[model samples]
Target: MRLILESKFQSLLLNWYSKNARILPWRSKPSLYKTVVSEFMLQQTQVKTMLPYFERWMRLFPSFEALSEANESNVLTAWAGLGYYARAKCLHECARGFVKNPVNSYRQWLNCKGIGDYTAAAIASIAFDEAVAVVDGNVIRVLCRLLSITESFKTKEVALKIIRPIANQFLSKTNPGKYNEALMELGAIVCTKQKPRCEVCPVKSCCKSYQKDTVHLCPHFFQVKRTCCTMQRYWIRDTHAFLLEPSTVGKVFRNTLQGLLELPIMTPQRMSVVGLGKLIFTGKRSIGPKDFIEQIYSPQKQVNSQSLMSLPEFSNCVRVPFDQRQRLACTGPHKRWISKLLQ
Candidate 1:
């Protein structure tokens, strides 16, 4: 990478970004707190989907001090609708850590709970004006096309050794914050994955993949087959309240959903003994590489809720009355299910 080319790329990118950058809420008045919250919420979530949640979160938590002082349950509740609950937990942890011992550098931020290399770089550069490059999915795609590198980014070594070095080389030292954002913005709106807007791309002449006409094939990726899964949940209700339980899905859910409630899961053994009851709600949800067919059931016979309470399964459950459902912190899916059931 020559200094002249780097300078040209930076000049082009910064100019394009200044004219076309999306007016995100955090971009208007960026602070360390806003940057951290937005980065955490944007992980594995699209800008459109996360916008509402981000606004709501800012109202609820406001600042690092507010978020750190909030209870774990409140934090989880505020983050309910967004799946990947782990990110919420990590953000909460980061807030607590920041409140305890504030950090300004990428290296220092990396020591926090969920601040990975990319997140640390983004926060440090965007909020603190550090001369570091951020290599998110969009940036990776842009880099691959710009340089015509066909190495699979699925491989960790390729991303770190090949992709990251190029990203660093292209980083604008004079104004790294704007430059990094410009590169990411370019990848997002113009250098898209499916059909890149090569004609209108600011740096199209400098892009090797465009010059070679290998734009689509430059960034190679391994395809992953998604698995299908079926799960059952019970919606047992008494006159006053509905019976719910803590999530028992897996270690990740248990950790993220520590203080939240969810509909009771119907395991194979439990289904065998208690039956699936009457199917009320059937829906499809996707999480990561797994597609889940979720079914909600009620008891076949009108068994008294109190009588079922004697059962060992109900011992660990909590009853949420219709009036108080709004106050309780339920999982995102379960919250929707319960709302539909009531309607």
Candidate 2:
């Protein structure tokens, strides 16, 4: 029964994919380099969100050799607004690795830095047709709903043990690449997390959850508590230049080799000297599990660079001219604030 059902599912998925797949840049022309770039950009990002970044990145660093030759600052600048700066750094290192030694298999890709199991499987299966199943979020959700696996995947071990075997079983032997893409596409557009279009789902009849009328409660997982924090940043400016601190210098920005600079955080000592300027920008942003309420203030009186630079808080800060700030690599929010301030 399982084998018969799997065969039916595969046919339905691949047939739907052939006609309804979105026309993405990477999909339009399937190449090893393009697949690598798209997978990296899509790590924690959606297709719509990463489309512009992918296009710009391809224009900036077209090939693996080109990306390998590019500097970290340039890479970070190109990936500035993408949020997860670490992915950019990993892609840079991966490019260099690919340039030196290109490998197509899943195991070989796993040996490369920052290429985890999912990424390795994706690249291997999608680019090389290696018959490996990719059990990403989309796949997991799809399978869980189809099989009515309601186990809480609070740990990686649990998820791998539960979902992986099923994914491999369902993966097509003749064309694993297209089959995997089709399953992911179904999850993305049809069997979505919220309002799933079950009526239009090609494999709706084969889905156990749909048959049982438990599609809404099919895929369940433990919820995580988000940490909320407030951040106060300063936008101190002199006549020609503004004080910006290197992201590498701060603890908050230590998540990655963020080669960008950000607006200085107003420490108590620094705040005592340079009073809070006019309120320039205030917004809330979430990265991973932490939610940040960020506020940027500009001082009313402009202090000289020498005095500001003498403070411990601004010791490593650089004075970037307003005109030249555009060229400098900066955190996403700071970059937008700087551009908006200029306008």
Candidate 3:
């Protein structure tokens, strides 16, 4: 009965997908390069947001050779506003790898930098119509509910064991690209996290959660508490310009050139207006005794040229306090700073 249900499940899903699949730019007979770029861009990012970036990127670097020849800075600059700059760096490295020994196959591209099983399978099946499985977050959610699996979905072992066979069952030899897209689309649109629209779902007829009328309860989830940290920042300014420093931390904005010309950051424990004045006057001879200091709770808001220029001392400093918190949101692990910057 299980085997029979599985056989029928593939047919219903494939048929529904063929009729309802969204017409996307990368899906119009997508090539290996286009598929790879799309897959990379889609990682932990929304499809709507990635659409414009993907289009612009393809225009800038039309081919693998173009990407390989482009400078690292140029690539990073292109990806400036986009968060997670590491992806851009990894992509550049991958392009170089591809140039070293170019291959038309999706498997060959997967061997390059930053390509993992999910990404590789997505590109392989979507671009080349290869019969491969892609087990992403959306796919995982769909599978967990389908099998009525109560175990934690976080474990890699559990995910691989459950998804590999299910993916294999639907991997179409005739139209792998369409089949893969259908599964992803079903997961993204129908089997969503908040409120799954089971009634209209293509796979609802066979879905275990729907059959049991426990669509909301089948996929068990757990939440973790987040920790918050508070820190201070300073935007230092001299006669000519403001001082800025590059971030040395690993997690957020790692290796990014921030605080282009700003102040020396002092923690809450070490911060005082008079103390800062003394440090500037005594510790650094460059800052004259006449240098002025202001208590700024948020550097992002207070460090503009107009604000700094208005101060008495050309060597002006603003102390800003920021509270950084790390937690998981609806999307994923979110790290944000709350301060007077917004107000």
Candidate 4:
């Protein structure tokens, strides 16, 4: 926390970051818009998982004008594989607002729906060079151990109180943007939750947790309890496995599944069975929980395309001919039921 150590601290991190920062598309040529998009997509999504999606999105909607011009259905389509539908909605609305009237201040960014405190700060500091710190999960872990703070960062209150001050003080005045990013990078690579490589850490000497030999115990993460909701989607396909578009009796299905063909879904209802996967495709899902479960059920038989299409559910959805419609697919994780239709 002293002047010399602080100076050394910032220097070590900056030097390391400048040399070793991961080469990402957005980081290569950063702009306000690019930074905003990356930050929004990065929320709840892994860097590797979001990489292709980000590149595709940038190519599709290169500017705020382009995004603002797109319809919600297309926007959602572009955001496929990246769950959390609400983020896409917010980003779309924000784009429209920005195109109408651009904003240059942190307060203005905060006014946008999808832009939260962390996102706003990241954009303001990284894009605009505002001397604010980003307090994401990585930053919290780094700071918690750096200063030997024992508080849980389950809530923003604890983070703001114990971690924010250190992060701000650690900020490099000459390049606060890179400094914030560097700190996050360090935590992600070196000061990890488990097996933290304290020896290689740039600021290990100045880290309270490292000095105390208690880096592992510093940031006590508070786990949020989450209950799984079972989801059921009905796949109504033609004789050739070409899916119906949920036009009539299941028009409601098409709204959520813009890119794919689907019928009425009976999701997250009562699931009588759940089991573990033990077969050829170990990693591939067979429905049910994460790291577990593969309950294979017989694919339901279907009537001729026209007959099923005429039924109540197929009234509104387009019943593209079996030969024309491509192999039917779902948006999220795959299920055995959908595959069985092909077999």
Candidate 5:
């Protein structure tokens, strides 16, 4: 396999990035706060999906001071439909920590809430102009294919050990920020997993996988085991619908449905008011939307507001008027269900 020389690789990658860099809000007028927030939102999320959310967030809370002063409910509401609720929680904490004493270095960011190595390196290089490498999925794919590292990326620690040094070597010493972004952009747009655009790729001559006719097999992937369970949900309404507050103990749906009201669907021993009323709604929500039957239930017996406050789980329940359901914070899945219910 013909190896890509460091100097030649850096020059071509940077030239390619100069012409093909994505015109993103965070990348356009770059700021420390914006970069940090964008990095957090972009984690496990696509750039296209995060664009509108990023614009909304910047408008809502433009700075560390604004974000730190805001409450968790407001934060989660602004971050709703983003899926990863823990990022909202951690970002809130990070804002608070950053406001107390600003972080300019990667090490300082590491100590802060939810900021991992990749984020730290990205923020440090992009915002602060520090000479460091950022290794994300895009970067990993690019490096693995360029050097032909046909190893599983599921084991993160072991994979990083292989890609990190190569990234450091090819990293632009003077323009590390642009270099990193360029690598990610190349991987995202050109070196795609399904069919790479080798003809248009700037570094195609240096890609070992392209030469070996094994680009598809370069970045090895692990098949994830998915377990699907059958859940029966019951709906109760008084003046409004019934939903539970986010809790750590005895909850199956994690932050996916945080700060929203959902049916009291539990595994076994969760404090729920399912059998308190007649079984008004009966339907099944499969793993996918290929076949879905919608059944709306209007409970005959009005839920007593008095009994809701009696239980620990029901204590956080608030009677959100049907008209004001939009004011409440709900996660993605339950939010869609509620939207469908309201419609």
Candidate 6:
């Protein structure tokens, strides 16, 4: 029964794919290096956004040897504003690994730094044309809806058990690259997570969830609520410039900003103005009144005497009332610090 269902799905998907697959630069001239890089960039990122970055990255790196030889700072700089600095770090590590000792086998490639199951499978099948399954979020969504699978994939063991075989069965021996890409495209365009276009879906006839008119429900969507935290920051200004500091917290811009700056972060429980002043001024000894600038308050609140005593770093305090600091705490650790020194 599984074999029959999978065969039908493969036929429909591959047929539709041959006609409608997106013409991407990576696809025009697929290579092990290019495919690997594309897959890495594509994870949790959109195709349109990745296009320019991908082109620039390829131009700079060109090949595994070139990427391996490039400086880490240059790579990180190139990846700036892309977010997910770790991916850049991992990509560099993987390139270095490949350059050090090249291997022909996909299995051997998997053992390289930063190569996980999805990445390994994608590179192996798309670049090498090996008959290996590529299972990612798209593939998972497509499979679950087509098969009407209700089991929660929250568990790694259960997800692998359900998806591995399906991927293996549908993997095209003749053109695994096209097959893998076609599956991803079907999920991206036709079998979308929200409001799937079932009528246009080539595999609709084979999709049990589509037949039942419950394609969206089959995947069991989960939502996470984000909590917002409040923080207070001070832009200490001197005659020449404001002080900035490297954030100690592991966040988006950690090691980047320069200068000796201090900002008071306001928590839910408001600290007394005096406490705030002490917190800001106690640590520093170099800054003086001549170096200070007129305090600029957010919302332009008039500074009272109480607020003035709270700050120890400066004779005067500027109150800047930002709307609110909302952060996705679970996303990662963040170190909030003064980013620039303005005179």
Provide TM-scores for the models: 0.91, 0.93, 0.71, 0.77, 0.85, 0.70
**lDDT tens digits, residues 192-277, model 3?**
97888888988887888788777777556454333333334443432334432333222233432332113344544324321343
Sort by TM-score, top down from the best: 2, 1, 5, 4, 3, 6
What do the candidate models score in CA lDDT, each in turn?
0.82, 0.85, 0.60, 0.67, 0.73, 0.62
lDDT (10s digit) by residue, model 2, range 204-284: 989988998888886777787899888888878777888888663335645653566888877887788887777888877
Which candidate number maximizes TM-score? 2
User: Which pairs clash in model 1?
Assistant: none
Candidate that scores best on lDDT: 2
Q: How does candidate 6 fare on TM-score?
A: 0.70
Which is the better candidate, 2 or 6, if ranked by TM-score?
Answer: 2
Off by over 4 Å in 1: 153-161, 252-259, 268-274, 304-310
- List the candidate 2 regions with Cα displacement exceeding 4 Å: 155-157, 248-254, 310-312
**Can you write out model 4's per-residue Cα lDDT over 11-83, one digit (the tens) per residue?**
9889999998999998997888898888889887878889998999999899899999988767876775675
Going through the candidates in order, what is the number of backbone clashes in each?
Answer: 0, 2, 11, 15, 1, 21
Q: What is the C-alpha RMSD of each candidate to the true structure, in Å?
A: 2.3, 2.1, 10.2, 6.0, 4.1, 10.3
RMSD of 5: 4.1
Candidate 5, position 187, lDDT: 79
Q: Model 2, residue 225: what's the lDDT?
A: 87
